[model samples]
Target: MSTSIRSIKSLVPLLDRVLVQRIKAEAKTASGIFLPESTVKDLNEAKVLAVGPGGLDREGKRVPMGVQAGDRVLIPTFGGSPVKVGEDEYQLFRDSDILAKINE
Candidate 1:
Protein backbone atom coordinates (compact mmCIF):
# COMPACT_ATOMS: atom_id res chain seq x y z
CA MET A 1 0.00 0.00 0.00
CA SER A 2 1.08 3.56 -0.68
CA THR A 3 0.96 6.31 1.88
CA SER A 4 -0.33 9.78 1.19
CA ILE A 5 2.01 12.72 1.27
CA ARG A 6 1.54 15.32 3.96
CA SER A 7 2.41 18.96 3.41
CA ILE A 8 5.04 20.65 5.56
CA LYS A 9 3.65 24.13 5.03
CA SER A 10 3.26 24.68 8.76
CA LEU A 11 6.99 24.17 9.32
CA VAL A 12 8.05 27.67 8.31
CA PRO A 13 11.26 28.70 10.00
CA LEU A 14 12.07 32.14 11.37
CA LEU A 15 14.43 34.68 9.87
CA ASP A 16 17.94 33.43 9.20
CA ARG A 17 16.86 29.97 10.29
CA VAL A 18 16.13 26.60 8.74
CA LEU A 19 14.62 23.23 9.54
CA VAL A 20 16.35 19.92 8.98
CA GLN A 21 15.46 16.29 9.29
CA ARG A 22 18.25 13.98 10.33
CA ILE A 23 19.11 11.03 8.17
CA LYS A 24 19.33 7.80 10.08
CA ALA A 25 22.51 5.83 9.80
CA GLU A 26 22.40 2.53 8.04
CA ALA A 27 22.13 -0.69 10.03
CA LYS A 28 25.30 -2.24 8.69
CA THR A 29 28.83 -0.94 8.88
CA ALA A 30 31.37 -0.66 6.08
CA SER A 31 32.35 -4.27 6.76
CA GLY A 32 28.73 -5.31 6.36
CA ILE A 33 28.15 -6.15 10.00
CA PHE A 34 24.70 -5.27 11.20
CA LEU A 35 24.42 -3.01 14.19
CA PRO A 36 21.74 -1.54 16.38
CA GLU A 37 21.03 2.07 17.17
CA SER A 38 23.00 1.93 20.41
CA THR A 39 26.03 0.49 18.66
CA VAL A 40 25.67 2.69 15.59
CA LYS A 41 27.50 5.99 15.34
CA ASP A 42 25.76 9.10 16.58
CA LEU A 43 25.57 10.84 13.20
CA ASN A 44 24.22 14.33 13.69
CA GLU A 45 24.15 15.07 9.98
CA ALA A 46 20.95 16.17 8.28
CA LYS A 47 19.45 17.51 5.06
CA VAL A 48 18.02 20.99 4.78
CA LEU A 49 14.34 20.99 3.96
CA ALA A 50 13.08 24.47 4.64
CA VAL A 51 14.85 27.81 4.92
CA GLY A 52 13.88 31.30 6.02
CA PRO A 53 14.33 34.52 4.15
CA GLY A 54 17.47 36.54 4.65
CA GLY A 55 17.97 38.16 8.02
CA LEU A 56 18.35 41.88 8.51
CA ASP A 57 21.86 43.13 9.08
CA ARG A 58 22.87 46.02 11.36
CA GLU A 59 22.28 48.39 8.46
CA GLY A 60 18.88 46.79 7.83
CA LYS A 61 20.11 45.10 4.66
CA ARG A 62 19.11 41.52 3.96
CA VAL A 63 21.88 39.04 4.58
CA PRO A 64 21.31 36.02 2.41
CA MET A 65 21.57 32.53 3.79
CA GLY A 66 24.57 30.61 2.58
CA VAL A 67 22.69 27.35 2.36
CA GLN A 68 19.43 26.51 0.70
CA ALA A 69 16.82 23.78 0.87
CA GLY A 70 17.92 20.28 -0.17
CA ASP A 71 21.51 20.84 0.86
CA ARG A 72 23.09 18.21 3.09
CA VAL A 73 24.61 19.65 6.22
CA LEU A 74 26.35 18.73 9.43
CA ILE A 75 25.14 20.08 12.74
CA PRO A 76 26.74 20.34 16.14
CA THR A 77 25.89 17.64 18.63
CA PHE A 78 24.79 20.23 21.17
CA GLY A 79 22.93 22.55 18.85
CA GLY A 80 19.36 23.18 17.76
CA SER A 81 15.97 22.49 19.35
CA PRO A 82 14.33 19.19 18.52
CA VAL A 83 10.77 19.04 17.28
CA LYS A 84 8.50 16.20 16.33
CA VAL A 85 6.59 16.33 13.05
CA GLY A 86 3.86 13.74 12.84
CA GLU A 87 5.77 10.49 13.28
CA ASP A 88 9.03 12.07 12.13
CA GLU A 89 11.44 14.28 14.07
CA TYR A 90 13.26 17.43 12.98
CA GLN A 91 15.43 20.21 14.33
CA LEU A 92 15.06 23.96 14.13
CA PHE A 93 17.95 26.32 14.66
CA ARG A 94 19.53 29.57 13.58
CA ASP A 95 21.70 29.68 10.49
CA SER A 96 24.74 29.80 12.71
CA ASP A 97 23.99 26.37 14.09
CA ILE A 98 24.94 24.72 10.82
CA LEU A 99 28.50 23.53 11.21
CA ALA A 100 29.28 22.75 7.59
CA LYS A 101 27.90 21.62 4.27
CA ILE A 102 28.94 18.40 2.62
CA ASN A 103 30.28 18.52 -0.92
CA GLU A 104 30.39 15.81 -3.57
Candidate 2:
Protein backbone atom coordinates (compact mmCIF):
# COMPACT_ATOMS: atom_id res chain seq x y z
CA MET A 1 0.00 0.00 0.00
CA SER A 2 1.50 3.31 -1.01
CA THR A 3 0.78 6.31 1.16
CA SER A 4 2.06 8.57 -1.55
CA ILE A 5 -1.03 9.73 -3.35
CA ARG A 6 -1.74 12.28 -6.02
CA SER A 7 -3.00 15.79 -5.27
CA ILE A 8 -6.44 16.25 -3.70
CA LYS A 9 -7.57 18.99 -6.09
CA SER A 10 -9.98 16.49 -7.65
CA LEU A 11 -12.38 16.54 -4.68
CA VAL A 12 -14.41 19.73 -4.60
CA PRO A 13 -16.78 19.47 -1.68
CA LEU A 14 -20.22 21.11 -1.81
CA LEU A 15 -21.55 24.12 0.10
CA ASP A 16 -18.47 26.25 -0.48
CA ARG A 17 -16.18 24.04 1.55
CA VAL A 18 -13.23 21.74 0.92
CA LEU A 19 -10.82 19.11 2.21
CA VAL A 20 -7.37 19.60 3.62
CA GLN A 21 -4.22 17.59 4.07
CA ARG A 22 -3.15 17.86 7.70
CA ILE A 23 0.45 18.71 8.21
CA LYS A 24 2.77 16.23 9.90
CA ALA A 25 3.73 16.76 13.52
CA GLU A 26 6.87 18.55 14.41
CA ALA A 27 9.87 16.27 14.87
CA LYS A 28 11.01 17.93 18.07
CA THR A 29 9.16 18.74 21.23
CA ALA A 30 9.30 21.96 23.30
CA SER A 31 11.97 20.33 25.44
CA GLY A 32 13.87 19.25 22.33
CA ILE A 33 12.86 15.63 22.45
CA PHE A 34 12.57 13.87 19.12
CA LEU A 35 9.35 11.97 18.58
CA PRO A 36 8.46 9.17 16.25
CA GLU A 37 5.43 8.89 13.99
CA SER A 38 3.78 6.13 16.02
CA THR A 39 3.64 8.34 19.11
CA VAL A 40 1.56 11.07 17.53
CA LYS A 41 -2.10 11.39 16.74
CA ASP A 42 -3.32 13.60 13.89
CA LEU A 43 -1.42 16.83 13.37
CA ASN A 44 -3.53 19.96 13.82
CA GLU A 45 -2.16 22.24 11.15
CA ALA A 46 -3.25 21.74 7.55
CA LYS A 47 -3.28 23.21 4.09
CA VAL A 48 -6.56 23.61 2.26
CA LEU A 49 -6.60 21.82 -1.09
CA ALA A 50 -10.14 21.57 -2.43
CA VAL A 51 -13.18 23.81 -2.02
CA GLY A 52 -16.85 23.74 -2.89
CA PRO A 53 -19.02 26.22 -4.65
CA GLY A 54 -20.35 28.93 -2.39
CA GLY A 55 -23.37 28.16 -0.30
CA LEU A 56 -26.67 29.72 -1.33
CA ASP A 57 -27.98 32.76 0.47
CA ARG A 58 -31.64 33.37 1.25
CA GLU A 59 -31.57 35.97 -1.50
CA GLY A 60 -30.60 33.27 -3.99
CA LYS A 61 -26.97 34.31 -4.17
CA ARG A 62 -23.79 32.35 -3.52
CA VAL A 63 -21.97 32.97 -0.25
CA PRO A 64 -18.32 32.20 -0.73
CA MET A 65 -16.28 30.05 1.62
CA GLY A 66 -13.95 31.95 3.95
CA VAL A 67 -10.88 29.92 3.13
CA GLN A 68 -9.27 28.91 -0.13
CA ALA A 69 -6.83 26.28 -1.35
CA GLY A 70 -3.23 26.59 -0.08
CA ASP A 71 -4.38 28.39 3.04
CA ARG A 72 -2.71 27.20 6.23
CA VAL A 73 -5.27 26.74 8.97
CA LEU A 74 -5.60 25.48 12.50
CA ILE A 75 -8.07 22.64 12.78
CA PRO A 76 -10.03 21.59 15.81
CA THR A 77 -8.75 18.42 17.36
CA PHE A 78 -12.19 16.84 17.67
CA GLY A 79 -13.63 17.92 14.34
CA GLY A 80 -13.67 16.37 10.88
CA SER A 81 -14.26 12.89 9.42
CA PRO A 82 -11.34 10.53 9.09
CA VAL A 83 -10.55 9.10 5.67
CA LYS A 84 -7.84 7.10 3.97
CA VAL A 85 -5.94 8.72 1.17
CA GLY A 86 -3.89 6.10 -0.54
CA GLU A 87 -2.24 4.18 2.35
CA ASP A 88 -2.16 7.09 4.81
CA GLU A 89 -4.94 8.49 6.94
CA TYR A 90 -6.37 11.91 6.19
CA GLN A 91 -9.41 13.93 7.28
CA LEU A 92 -12.55 15.12 5.52
CA PHE A 93 -14.37 18.01 7.09
CA ARG A 94 -16.26 21.15 6.24
CA ASP A 95 -14.70 24.61 6.50
CA SER A 96 -16.08 24.76 10.01
CA ASP A 97 -13.51 22.24 11.18
CA ILE A 98 -10.94 24.91 10.74
CA LEU A 99 -10.41 26.85 13.96
CA ALA A 100 -8.19 29.64 12.71
CA LYS A 101 -6.24 30.79 9.71
CA ILE A 102 -2.46 30.68 10.17
CA ASN A 103 -0.71 33.85 9.08
CA GLU A 104 2.50 32.08 8.27
Best by lDDT: 1
Local accuracy of candidate 1 as per-residue lDDT tens digits, 1-104: 12232555577787898888887899898999998768767687899999899689999987898789999998888868777755677887788779899985
How well does each candidate superpose onto the true structure, as a TM-score?
0.82, 0.74
Global lDDT of each candidate: 0.81, 0.74
- TM-score quality measure for candidate 2: 0.74
Question: Lowest-scoring 10 consecutive residues by lDDT in candidate 2?
Answer: 1-10
**Model 1 weakest lDDT span, ten residues long:** 1-10
Off by over 4 Å in 1: 1-9
Question: Pick by TM-score: which candidate is best?
Answer: 1
Query: Taking the tens digit of each residue's C-alpha lDDT, what string does model 2 give over 1-104?
Result: 23344654445578856677789877779999988878866668888877777778899898878888888988888767665656656666676567899998
Q: Which residue pairs clash within candidate 2?
A: none
